[model samples]
Target: MVTIEYIVDLVNKHNVWRGKECINLVASENVMSPLAKRLYVSDFMHRYNEHFEKSHYQGTKYCMEIEGFVKRIFGERFNTDKVEPRPLSGGQANLIVLAALTSPGDTIISVGLTSGAHVSHTKFGVVGVLRLEEKVAVNNEDLTIDVDATARLIREKNPKVIILGRSLVLFPEPIKELREEIGWDIPILYDVAHVFGLIYAGKFQEPFEDGADIITTSTHKTFPGPQGGMIIAKKDFPDKLWEKIYYTTFPGLVYNHHIHRLPALVVTALEMNAYGEEYATQIIKNAKKLAEELYDRGLKVLCADRGFTETHQILVDVRDYGGGAKVAEILEDNNIIVTKVALPWDTPKDATENPSGIRIGVQEMTRYGMKEEHMVTLAEFFDRILNRRENVRREVTVFRKNFQKVHYCFNNI
Candidate 1:
């Protein structure tokens, strides 16, 4: 059996041993709520119950209850007609949806990797590996998807599916306009791996209402749940689509999900229902604050005039800090964790080894109870480091020591 003492020691050793620590700005990350963690830790182990059980096993009654609870919660929050909570990860969700909707040779439109599109849709990742035809690109300005270009591409290539919502997307896409352009001949799928939780908490534009046919997301990111995947579809798809997803999730793909995580998924849904709105609002507020502070310090942050972001992420062109990897390294010296991102149009010359910018956000810190004021403080640290890299190194060592005092995850630090 597991012991609380053991868990507590692990949390202290791993999670909290650093100061002003873990301001992880990776937009695709969040601290899971305690309830979510509990659920993840206490799930039941089960055999392959291939389909949703009508008694595939004798004692799956409770499993059904929890699974149903997860479905119901997602149904109400996302307001989608169907929900599949069994994909092993967000990438699997995209794969199943694509398999269900498009044939191997059928064309799909998504953003290119440099443009912040996910690997699941781009030809470079699973989509490419799976032999799916794909067209991907970036916007001209504002760094979001370019609707006009998309329309032109759609008119010419006429892809069967269009996948929106890339990994680094901060502004809204042209889904409604694109839908009007396409007129339902082609279906649009939203890979909301980063923004679905924000949508659930009312911090993002709803793709379903805005004309998307389907949405796939990770349950963990902004939803702050267990690391799992979900696929939500409109009321119009035939039952076969769901069956395809169900089969792919079980025998077709994952054998059995982490049963313990089911409880966490259910509780995450509840927490999202309860405190999600406020949490999401504050997260955006924290992001905006961080961006503004960085800008005020004269940094070249993206989308400043356009509000830099409407979500919990901000990408800064840190070319002056000797590129992304160097900037990331300097920030790490200060106990501030962030990543280097390659801009949509960047190329091999802009790889992480020498990328053009740094990306940061407040999701993890926000989940840990920090706010706008904290954001400014964090930015100030970055400013000092960037402006005085050599001088701040020793100072940052002291700050790093203090970062260990704050609590973060419950176990495994």
Candidate 2:
């Protein structure tokens, strides 16, 4: 058997190397603050809490306190009525929301995976519970969600729950119109995993105002917290609904919940409360600038004709470069990191084998202090490699050294 200690040591080495080199452009990744990282690796690593403290856990007074703080931070940041901070991951949080709102075999309507919807919302992930029976996509021209298409699908299929959100949102979701079409009886689940920070900062769509029944998100994405999840409901919430989360989470599903991540998340939320708006704005600006620069450098960014993006992420079609995976590989060779993604209209097989798009985002690099000028320079680096210019490695190394000298890493500060 592989020894756990060796694995742990290897992971530590990998973290160190990952920290020092490479520009992380993957949409779902973020660098935690040193304070947050410390909390995750400390006593919190050894201890586990299983109950809500009012129930079965043995030593959970302090755990509940931290968890309470975490929930309060989320409540204040998002202006939601209540927040539950105990889900193990965003996917888990989404699963809990699905379980709470719908029963087995209930139909769920969501964006298809090619349209940037996460697996958790589909039959592939939560089908054992959610039973996703309908999915919609966006208009090919602007890559925006097709509200009319969604309305027609809902009218035809009549799903029990309608989920409006995405893994690669470039603009505000069409929540206001969708709710109006579906009426108030159906549960509208907003999976705001990618845009939670942007939403807090007043840059994304307002889910509550538009009538979403429940909101689920990952704390790490734009919220800039440690890796964990949250589920929020509007005020005047029912106790039975909350009970679903509590029961499913405790004995039904997850155990050994990380109590320490909550405190760190609380700290991160406080930081978000202070700088969330400006950070979100800067992140969007950088995203647009990067996408535009890349397009100008002969890359094909989705929605380039409609303004690269309003959010931090932009999808570039890399089909000309042997598809997204090949483009991602070439970029990785030059110290940049991005992920392969399927276009909203691509098939599942295309997504798995030869997806046509690359997902890039500005959140992490923005947190690292890069701006539009850096985006232009980064785009030039891509040009060097893609256009097959001479001395590509040496040129990129010099450019990266200059960028690093700006002291972008949080620890360097």
TM-score of each: 0.89, 0.91
Q: Which lDDT tens digits does candidate 2 get at residues 172-229?
A: 7778887777677777788999998888777887878878878889988877878888
Candidate 1 — number of clashing residue pairs? 12
lDDT of 1 by residue, 1-413 (tens): 89999999887876653324444666777766655665575537443343554645566778878888888888877676588888878998998888777777888888777778887888877778667888874466667766777788888998878888888878777789887776877878888888777888877898878888888999878778888898988767567866776676666676667666788787777767767788889888988998999899988999888989988779999887788898888777656778888875468677646888888867777777777887777778777778755446455445444333212333332
lDDT of 2: 0.76
Number of clashes recorded per candidate: 12, 2
**Residue 253 error, candidate 1, Å:** 1.4
Ten-residue stretch with the least lDDT total in model 2: 404-413
Give lDDT: candidate 1, residue 266. 78
Candidate 2: the clashing residue pairs are: 114-344, 115-344
The ten-residue window of minimal lDDT in model 1 covers 404-413
